[model samples]
Target: MNFDKRAQLIRKYDVPGPRYTSYPTVPYWKNEPLSNEEWLQSIHRNQKHFSSDDVSLYVHLPYCESLCTFCGCHKRITKNHSVEQPYIDAVIKEWQLYKSAGLEKSRIKELHFGGGTPTFFQADELVRLVHSLLENQQVDPSEVEMGFEAHPNNTSKEHLEKLHTLGFRRLSLGVQDYNPRVQKAINRIQPFSQVKKVHELARGIGYNSISHDLVFGLPKQSLKDMLFTVEKTLELRPDRISLYSYAHVPWVKRTGQRGFDENDLPTGEVKRELYEQAKLRLLDVGYLEIGMDHFALKEDSLAQAFLSKNLHRNFMGYTTQNTPMLIGLGMSAISDSWFGFAQNKKSVEAYIDGINKDQLPVFRGHLLTKEDLVIRQHILDLMCHFETELGVHDSFDFNLNVLLRLKGMVEDRLIEIDGNTLRITEEGIPFVRNVCMIFDQSLQSSASREGVFSRTI
Candidate 1:
């Protein structure tokens, strides 16, 4: 992956594509209503394959006092602190509904609190929420992998200490960047000292596996800004670093990304360089690259999983644990039963309304077809391990037509086809999404792909 070759590939492959966080993505899902019976059947099917005790839980906290213009997550903007307790109560009720609907699995193997900002709620509010979630029983911190997303500016020492006491060992701080210009453009104005304080506090509180989120291709971001940010990140030496590509989809996010001028964003090669150089800096400092844009130390669980080719990517992005059922509990949250995908109401009011009716709150869903199941395995393997084998699927035909579609990638040295196996080259790491897209029959046939996704490179 030399500089010249990298630049050429970036220019050639810079096209709109889904992030492949989920197979059949969301747009390709059927638009019909998700019935209660259908969702239950999916859950029953999942239970047959997975252990009843092993479950992954994702709780989405969609409240943020201030808006970070670059964000694409579904969230409610408000300065009102009163929205906190009510929202927690609604989420707890939703969890109860899942239990009544046949979600008997109680032992959570992986639990993550993600949001507009998980720290937006008061410390006591989080306690009540988690207590109800775990059935008012104290959990052994070692029994579960608990993590949360925090805004460094708002993540107080009390927040860290309280969460640590409740079995939360992982902390992901939204550093985004240390560059003031980049911070101002994104409207997440936190100083380096503020982030430093939070990082030190989390470590002092005995939290493990700290991850810092840094974005490339941001508005007004330059090579110097990236270097400085990387330098500051190294100062803290967090366990994991997520070098995310800034998805500037103003058309989709509407007003969220409209605050900053689009012209200021780095595109194509410039955007790739920001990541490439920063990746080099991270690798030089002993950080090993994980799946996609994530990097971690060798001792980190994510890094260990990657080394063993067991890393997985779902709607939670990349994760160490790949449960048979991932139940997302919150507004706009998505649940996956391995063979089916269901989403809750997008609007906060609608979500709360549906929950009050003693329902699952799922509005739409898709049951995976035979072809979808085969393609999903291929995409998941490619995304997590950078390779896949044709022999895995007995019913699906991995024939000449599919090979013809991937000929361009093979010729460009982005991938190497060894008999019935296909592997992404080191240079092809950036084009993993493109390779996966070719196998996506729905995306390939969909005319809506132009605006529905961001650039792959």
Candidate 2:
């Protein structure tokens, strides 16, 4: 199909869909019967799978100096530096509880620092925190990969150098947009000079990978504005680029996105055009598409992961490793033990209260059923590998449910289905979420349900 036809399909199919960061996404988790004992037991049972050294760590630092209106992440917008030490203390305490539960520190293969802004903390504080973690754990530096998210406006050279010295080789800077008008609308007044400086600074300090986080479909974002952002991004030539579609979920985030009206944001066909133009521009500048909403130059590790078929997806988005055990520390973090999923309290006060009481901060979780696990595998394959084959199983019968759902998509030339295997065609690339929704049993069951997710297109 041609661009015009593809554009039309995108407009028609670009309805609300889940990002599928996790199966039975967080909202669907049943927390009523989730107890600390069950969570710990699940962790122990899943740790056995890490005998070959396959575990990942996600450390969430939820503090930020200010709130970006377009952000949908869980965060506490505060300027008080005093909040930092207490949060770090709580995180370390939580880690201690996990350590006491018999999780061998040697099994950790990847560590990622994500949050409102990891660079919000002082450089010395970050160094101290990381050092303490390394001291308590038996981490293999050679096999470990560590990275963090930084705000370009406040990420100083010292911050980059300090983190780099502490085994952090990858850095992601949030550069949502370069347009002054768009920035004002989102209340994120970051100058391109600052972003460019930070990008060069990270590369200059020998950081292996530097990723720029860009967003499309924001309020007042036109094709020209997107072209400018892409052109400016190409000039910097970061190692990786995460081109995200702006999720306008005011009903969920509430206050964070209330500054602007929903109608001001780009809609169906226009939004699709913005993405297509950006993709073409990035490709022309030598960026290789790596799965959904992410692009990496040929030399980047993510691109290499694609080539080796080792690319993996988790709550933290794309990863290079397929670790079975992921332990999340800090406020509102979610832990995946392969067999189960647990999330800490979203409130900082509640997280602190649990830590002070010597309790695991988790308040909710789900133990994956046989069907959940099977569906999760299919979703992961489609999200990371872009293809999946169904296995004959007692719980889920292999039939035309998926193919039947894809029939419309197939007619639109969005996907092509073989026997039991399905692959997202090039035209379907932008609508990957729509393709995956065919296998999303939970979503289908809750389709009539209000306030679920944003459009997949």
Candidate 3:
């Protein structure tokens, strides 16, 4: 599509909405959270269905030496190395809680370390953490995928080597922008040299899938800056690229984003243009768009998954791994039991205390109803594959109101509905969230959109 057309569409459809990482997204989850016992039962049920099958694991290492003003993730900022060991110990204990809850022992299909910075810990400390989780367990080495988020400024050669030795084949380096003004605005001023060094180190250590993360619409960001960032990124030739829209949600993350002047941030058309510039440049360099806000080389597994319709998304973002269960360990981590969703205590102190008491540390969760499941599947289909089919399952009664609500989208050529199937047109891909919202019974029931989500653009 041309720039004028995309800009026009952006004006028409840009609105606050959930990314649909989870259908009946967290804010719309049932008021009565799932109990600890209920959460465990969901896990047991998952295990029963996929007996001895490998499950996915997400470990939250929520510590960073310095705060990135643009970051919205749950993290504690401190320079103290003393806290690392205690946090790692608590994470191990939390994993054991799931083991006691009947999670398949030593059988993991995918493991991801996300955080304030997974590279915050020393090399040996990471080894200890991975060993503690893998000890006496069976991992699907052939199919097992392990990865982590790294800070280019702090990630060391030893960190890459040690993690690679532990079967971690993927690394996502946070390189939001290399523009000095933008970096200063976001309070994440790592030089491009730092990122390049880390990238070379990881590649030399045999890490197969290295992803560079870039963000548009940051405070003081411009089309030129976005192009420069993508150009510099292509010079490194990462296996994957996560080109994201910088979500400025001061209401939700007041302190972390306080460093910048919101007035200086790009908005509306300018922000959309920044993304289009990045997207075009990346595609020119042979990177294929995968799902939303992500791109991968044709040889990358993410691209392969996208082509095969096997791509999956969860709290951990996009992945090729699909498992009935995902166990999240550490503060503010979330677990998916296929039938339910549970989140750990947000505070490190509270999480550690709960773990010491032999508790699951989950303070909130939601058990999906049949209808919720059906809607969840449709949303996932649209988000991952840009299409969905209704009335294909007995669990759901096809709601015509959805079609009625989306009538404008059809008229706008953003989507097509033929019989029981719905497909998002190429022009509709950017508005996939808006398309999904038509089927969101909860959001529709609430009928008030103020202060609930970031804009869909």
lDDT of 1: 0.88
* Count of steric clashes across candidates, in order: 0, 0, 2
Error of 2 at 338 (Å): 0.8
TM values, all candidates = 0.97, 0.96, 0.97
Please report how far candidate 3 places residue 230 from its true position, in Å: 0.4
The weakest ten consecutive residues by lDDT in model 1 span 392-401
Q: Which ten residues in a row have the lowest lDDT in candidate 3?
A: 391-400
CA lDDT of each prediction against the hidden true structure: 0.88, 0.85, 0.87
Q: Tens digits of per-residue lDDT for model 3 on 352-425?
A: 99999999999888888888888889998888888899667623334767767989999889999898889999
Better of 1 and 3 by lDDT: 1
Q: Rank the models by lDDT, top first.
A: 1, 3, 2
* Stretches of candidate 2 exceeding 4 Å from the true structure: 49-53, 136-142, 392-398, 447-449
